[model samples]
Target: MRIVVAVSLFFLTSTVFAQTKKPASKAVAGPGQQVYEQYCLTCHQADGGGVPNLNPPLKQTDWVQGDKTRLINVVLKGLQEPIEINGETFDNVMPAHDFLSDKEISDVLTFIRSSFGNKAEPVSVEEVKKVRAAK
Candidate 1:
């Protein structure tokens, strides 16, 4: 009867819709990995350790481990003054990465915070956006 036909059509439509549904994309390593590869790798290398007296390694560094806000600021505004990494002084002028998109910045920060023996929480796009908006 009509009910049977309607039920059949509903099931058919549901099946078609289910089949057409797109599979979700795999979870990315997130913004941090993407940004690091694009920008930081040139100096820091893939290992998070920089050349001697050059870029300075981020591993167990106070700048990256001591305070989250300070690290975030460094990424947003760039570091110009000399910085001490693992007791070694690095005076290189860290060019301002302020031009990066919020997502990119966030990803880079997250990568830095977590990689190379660092265990900081991932940086959020919203946090990056907030920092950018502040200045």
Candidate 2:
């Protein structure tokens, strides 16, 4: 009985004196990154180096860094025609992502433009909204 009481008291004291460990700081995924992982990670890959001969890469590509409106439209209306980039032709089809909201599209475009070693301006929500409305 004395041993059990001592053990219980020790555990209770330890519990009262225990210190909490600080949580490790982690890089939080933004809304755009979450959207990309869900919808674009498959074809574009995690590094944005798309599948060879199947999908065009997003690294330092003009299409990803070019006009914001055109990029927005491409997301809204899937590309059907084959396009060549860096002397490489990709005939694979890219399905439309029109189901995404204007904010989502804009955030994703901005994320793409900034990722994969591309330094480009962000795509505003208004810009995406305007392009979607025009279509």
Candidate 3:
């Protein structure tokens, strides 16, 4: 009886392990994506459509794809005034994220510019440093 039970348990465990085995995921998120998910995803949302009348949507907005210097400054200095984008006015206060490193800022900006259907150039770490220095 013991021998039969041991064999049954061994086969059951082996079958369970075999059935539970899963393929490794191939869609690993990039560093920029990681940063966006960690910080920007809250306000901007995963789809880049911000909350109505509060945080502005990032989808194809000039702010994401426009002048690099101005965009970088927006991240470093934060915007307090009510701003209009695509004819929509957003009055929410965007706190300054100056604590993020130049690379982090650059990566996040680049991620935003490339994502959300915006075809802007990538923001280099050097550019972020320059903008941060100017402030």
Best by the TM-score measure:
2
Look at candidate 2 and tell me the lDDT of residue 26: 21
TM-score of 3: 0.78
User: What are the per-model numbers of colliding residue pairs?
Assistant: 2, 0, 0
Once fitted onto the true fold, the runs of candidate 1 whose alpha carbons sit more than 4 angstroms away are 1-30
lDDT of 3 by residue, 1-135 (tens): 999999999999998887666332322466777888998889989989998998999989988898999899888988889899889998888888888889999998988898878888899999999988888
Instruction: Sort the candidates on lDDT, descending order.
Output: 3, 2, 1
Order the candidates by TM-score, highest first — what do you get?
2, 3, 1
Per-residue CA lDDT of model 2 for 45-124, tens digit only, reads: 99999999998888888789988888898889988788997679999899999999999998888888888888999999
Best by lDDT: 3
RMSD of each: 6.9, 5.9, 5.6
Q: Which 10 consecutive positions of candidate 1 have the poorest summed lDDT?
A: 22-31
lDDT of each: 0.79, 0.86, 0.87
